[model samples]
Target: MHTAITSQPLPSAAEAALARESSRVLSACLQTRSDAQQIELHDEQGATHPVRVPVSALRLLLDVLTEIGAGNAVSIIPIHAELTTQEAADALNVSRPHLVRLLEQGDIPFHKVGTHRRVRYQDLMAYKQRIDAQRHEALDALAEEAQRLGLGYD
Candidate 1:
């Protein structure tokens, strides 16, 4: 079964408050680099339950909360997950055929599963980072060349 992942709605007032609190807690806990911490949750029944959370998980939660606090929707995807070419293309914001060409050229790594290519989420992210770095370097070089020619913005 396939499940669609979508960004969540903006946080409500109460949620915003919780987000603030979570951010504060995360900031404090991250400084100590604690392995795990237990958080108390109080339900409508007035019963408190303690749940253990890893520091990494808490950090991710804080990031999500911060985005929501800023009125931005957020969604999470695991880095190790496998993705189809179409899904990878959608994530990369490119046409499927373009992505296929990239795959064919070995620009992005993929493995075939019964004739269907599957890309790892981490691999795609790594490729994106590489492309972004290359783009940044090229832009920097262009700016330097323009500056050398006295064509830079005032």
Candidate 2:
């Protein structure tokens, strides 16, 4: 199923604390060598239920919990999903106009449906990775230049 891109609010302090504790417990459980793991869930009425989940799914849950524990908002988008221009912009943390410019410049590819532009999640991620790598390379170069110049940036 394709999930629409949406912004999620950061976890509240109480929720963050609970997530931190839950992540810690789940981390311990994930250290087992089993392919699947059984975990217990406790309801408000003090009823306990056990559920068996694939280790991969458990690892994903742990990642979500870890982000929430750090008070960060998290959104899951399937790799095959198509996003609207605005959604793609939001994913890149850029303005829609800027993203449109990138699309027009051919820095990223997009397809149109009924006059609306749609970007593939995978393409957007590829573009992001490319730009991020370039940025890191530029930064590393600047740092090297600074060290060579004896600018005291040791």
Candidate 3:
């Protein structure tokens, strides 16, 4: 059997880099100064580059990176709590038939608990999170365009 890629962080160098990045992320977040100027990104060479991003985007970035570093990233997560197809579908906000299609396509992992196929609850959550992120991105694009055009948002 092939060795599983443990979700655990890799060795020292990678871990250190992640820590440094996380620190920068935290610093960016802790900047509560009003009249916030444009964000200045410091490069490895100590060169400062100004980049303008909405505060909302920065906050979202902080949240996503923090979650990933905490091993709680919305990506595929192995779960201990097992659930049947119907249960998994409900957890994922999809229909049982849709889950069955995913099973047939070998898109999701599952085990046969005696006769019924079962999936991990964490896996269902991870899948839903992934789908939600994609939907959010598309909606964000439309919203951005609407904002740019001064079009109807409500």
Ranking by TM-score: 2, 1, 3
Ranking by lDDT: 2, 1, 3
Q: Write the per-residue lDDT of candidate 1 for residues 1-154, one digit (tens) a residue.
A: 2223454677788878877787887777677556988889999999999999887888888898788776677878787788888888888999999999999999999999889888888898999999999999999999888888999554
Which residue pairs in candidate 1 collide?
Answer: none
Number of the predicted model whose lDDT against the real structure is largest:
2
Query: What is candidate 3's local distance difference test score?
Result: 0.68
Clashes of each: 0, 0, 0
Every model's Cα RMSD, please?
2.7, 1.8, 15.1
User: Candidate 1: misplaced stretches above 4 Å?
Assistant: 1-21
lDDT of 2 by residue, 40-137 (tens): 89999999999999999999999999999999999988899999999999999999999999999999999988898999999999999999999999
Task: Assess the local accuracy of residue 39 in candidate 2 as a C-alpha lDDT between 0 and 100.
Answer: 78
Best by TM-score: 2
**TM-score quality measure for candidate 2:** 0.90
| Deviation (Å) of 18 in candidate 1 | 5.1
State each model's CA lDDT, in order. 0.83, 0.93, 0.68
Between candidates 1 and 2, name the one with more favorable TM-score: 2
